[model samples]
Target: MAAAKDAIKNRERLLASVILVSLICGWVAGLFKHHSDIAGFLKQALPGAVRFDSSEDNIYTGLTHAQSESKKAGFVAVRSAHGYAGPVTVAVGLDANGKIVNAVIVRHTELPAFFRRVTDNGFPGRFKGKDCSDQFEIGGDVDSVTGATVSLAALAEAVRVACSDIATGRLGLLPIVKNKPAIQFGLPEILLILLIVTGFAAYGKKLPANTYMKWVVLAASLVFIGFVLKRPISLININSLLVGYWPRWQNNVYWYLLLAVLLLPVILRGKTPYCSNICPFGATQEILIKLGGSRRQLPEKCSQFFKVLQRSLAWIAVMCALVFRNPAIITYEVSATFFTIIGQNWQFVLLALVLILSLFIARPWCNCLCPVRAVSDYVRLLRRGFTR
Candidate 1:
């Protein structure tokens, strides 16, 4: 028994080392190819400007297709802001008098569907002719994109900040003094906190009443976290962690709160509190299992095979995300589609299949495809390797 334990420990250490090395190698390779084409980005932001002068403080003077003595066409300012999944870099072009010529999304790690929805709805076009001093508030001056509110806020802020920098530094205007952002502690935050607290309170308790409480929490998670808020843990969160993409804390308190809730138990006890207790998708699957009366379990050999397949798919997904430096690249999770109702045709098909299979299979996606579970497993392995 001691010999078997030692062998198992050795294999786990080896697996941890391999996973770490792959992640490091992927990150390094991605760094070499991560630079955006600034010239192309500027051209898109400021059309009719043939040439750009030297950049000073991220502000580039745009020159028309005229002689050297010609007046400046405009200025392009580059800035980035925290989006829903990661940083969104934008280029804002402003005329001599400080009116916006155009705004273009240079690069972003946001969900591709949400970002595309914003762009397709003429979100950037609405910035044209706005003055540097104008408020770029999502619902105040700029119209909000439905389903992409966080992304819209980030893009708007990126443009606004860049414009402010240009106005004060290059255009010789006063600094735009804006009020500080208040902490957004609202219903969503309150509900999530309550749910997490309830989950932890009920953990490891054998009280009969706790069983009823468990069902209540799960139902609440399904309704609020999954449907109402449309914010469930996904691969994007894992990719963001690996890529060091942190959204702002003031307005995105729920984001940090969720991460802490998901990871704290794993780091402390090698337990996945989120999966068994707080995940809305997990709750959905459990409910499905209850309704379908699926007491079936996969055979030992089959379970092992599927587990290996799950780890491989997850590893490949994370590696691709790191190499490309875009969290949106890892969007195979069906939770996003089910909650947001915004995904590609294939994703919808996959969601339907998963739901249909949930009737008889009992949490097939959680057991055989969740990247979060794979990540949790990796964290547990590393923790055990270090502590033991």
Candidate 2:
């Protein structure tokens, strides 16, 4: 018992040391790369002939530029707003008349595919003619993207704030438009909350664990969360939190509820209800397992080694995200493929292989490579450590 305890302690210490070093190194690397990236982005986004002078204010850091040819002056403000995965830094250009000239995404940690969607759909173009006088509310005046609503909303809000800063601070104009209400509760949020509550009731043994009940939950997850919402919790979600990129609570009720449902049970009872009961990919794998009606167990040593590999991959994913400030770079999970049905060829192949393997092995992906499970295990370890 004493030897085993010593081994556990040694392993925990090693893990903690590795994580600390990785985070410190990642932060340093990110710092060096981030400034150059921002400078390049600002140059590209702004007009070529104008020289930009940094604003004197510390709070609203911006650039004041005067056109060499026309002598027209404008301001470029860099503002950040909360996106679905993280904060999006946008550069907003305002002419001296308070009219928006251009809005460009300077830097963001949003998912690459979603970012592409936002760009392709001309989300930034909508703000080109708007001024501080226009209300920047989505659905009120500014239209939001269908799939990338949160990201679009965030970008719009960022531009609005930047324009407001220039209008009031630089132009000496009084604020004309009232800020839009932040909170928005819709069908998606309601359904997600209900789904989480049902998962808790089912997993907590408050509801009967009948076959029908399981099937109902599985179907709901597959259809609503997977196909319709396309909002399955992923490694990127955890990475966003680790990097201190919290979703705006007022505008992102769905995100908040999902996190609460996934985390609270794990912290309190060591129960990963999200993975075991609520994950759409897990449901799909379970369905495959049932159809295959075959099971295989690896040797204890092999299982232990795979578990270590799983946790290591999780660590690598988080570190990569931290270092690069891009969640898409480290997103290896097949959940997006299953939920969105639109991803790279490599992702498709990976999802196919995992589903095929799930026929013989129960949750092969979850056991070997699921980053979410690894995160849940870490939370469980924390819970156990605190209790001890």
Candidate 3:
């Protein structure tokens, strides 16, 4: 029995190492391919440019060729900003007068629906001929896209950063280095921290109000983290961090705080309090089960089969995101469908099925299909390996 257990541990660790190595290699190859594709995107941003000066970095100079003259057309700079899902990269074309001639999204991992909304609402066109120094803030100088504020902000920031690079380097503008922003500790962070602390403090205690407290925490998480903020930790965020696409810490304190809330407990105690006690979607299902007055659990064999399927799907999703270097590619998270009411047709259908099934089984989604649970399980496995 001991030998068998040791062999299984060795196999699991070896498989994990193989997967990690493959992901790194694939990410590196994708970077080279993406680099080759940027020149074409730059040309699209600056159509009149006949040629561009070669450079290894994100900044470049465009040249227009006449019969005997090669004159400087403008400068192009590429920059990326953290979006709702992942990084949004834009290539900005600046004329000699330090005005944006055009800007194009070179690459992005934003959700297709949000990206489409921005494009349909003429978001990029709003930046044309804008001065490089102009504050590209949404709802001020730039128009905001309804239902896509995060995407719009990210796209605008990408363009603004690129323009600032060109303005400071070539156009001789004063550097705009502001002091580092203070941590954004807001209602969301406060609420999340309170929920975690209260939940852990009350767990497994014999107090009469313990059950009631759990429900209260769940309800609060559902309302704030789900409907109001609409920023539940998802696979997209996890993949972003894993692939080195971290958001700005000061501007995204809630993001980092949520990650810590989810990860620290697992790292320290091998317990996942967030998913068990604070997941908005899990709360929704629990509420549905309570209201429907049915709590039928799946048979053990069937439950085991579904658990395996869930882990396999999660692994495949993560691997695809890493290899393609786009976290949003396989983001069919049902939480997005239930909370923000944002997702595709299929996601809505999946959400409906999960909700319907919740009336029969207790947390069908959490028990059978949640990617977060799968990730936590793998993390715990790693923890066990290291502890041993």
TM-score of each: 0.94, 0.84, 0.90
- Per-residue alpha-carbon lDDT of model 3 for 56-150, expressed as tens digits? 66688899984447888899998999998788888899999998889998788888976888999986877999999888888888888777888
lDDT of 1 by residue, 202-283 (tens): 6766446888878888899999999999999887887887877877678789988888888778989999668877899989
Among these predicted structures, which one has the highest TM-score?
1
| Runs in model 1 lying further than 4 Å from the true structure | 1-5, 65-67, 206-208
lDDT per model vs. reference: 0.86, 0.77, 0.83
Give per-model CA RMSD. Answer: 1.9, 3.6, 2.9
lDDT (0-100) at residue 343 of candidate 2? 70
Task: Give one clash count per candidate, in the order shown.
Answer: 0, 0, 0
On lDDT, the stronger of 1 and 2 is 1
Q: What local lDDT score does residue 32 receive in model 3, on the 0 to 100 scale?
A: 55
Highest-lDDT candidate: 1
| Residue-level lDDT tens digits of model 2 in 1-388 | 9999989977886676666677779867866664534555455445542456675651222343443344435767788888877888888777778887777887777777767778888868668878766778877888766667777878878887888877888789997676646586899898888777777677766777655666677779878999998988888877777666786677778887877778888898888678877888888888888899977766789889989999998888888878877665677788887777657789899999999989988888888889889888887776666677
Give the range where candidate 2 is weakest over 10 consecutive residues by summed lDDT: 58-67
Alpha carbon deviation, residue 313, candidate 2 (Å): 0.9
lDDT of 3 at 48: 80
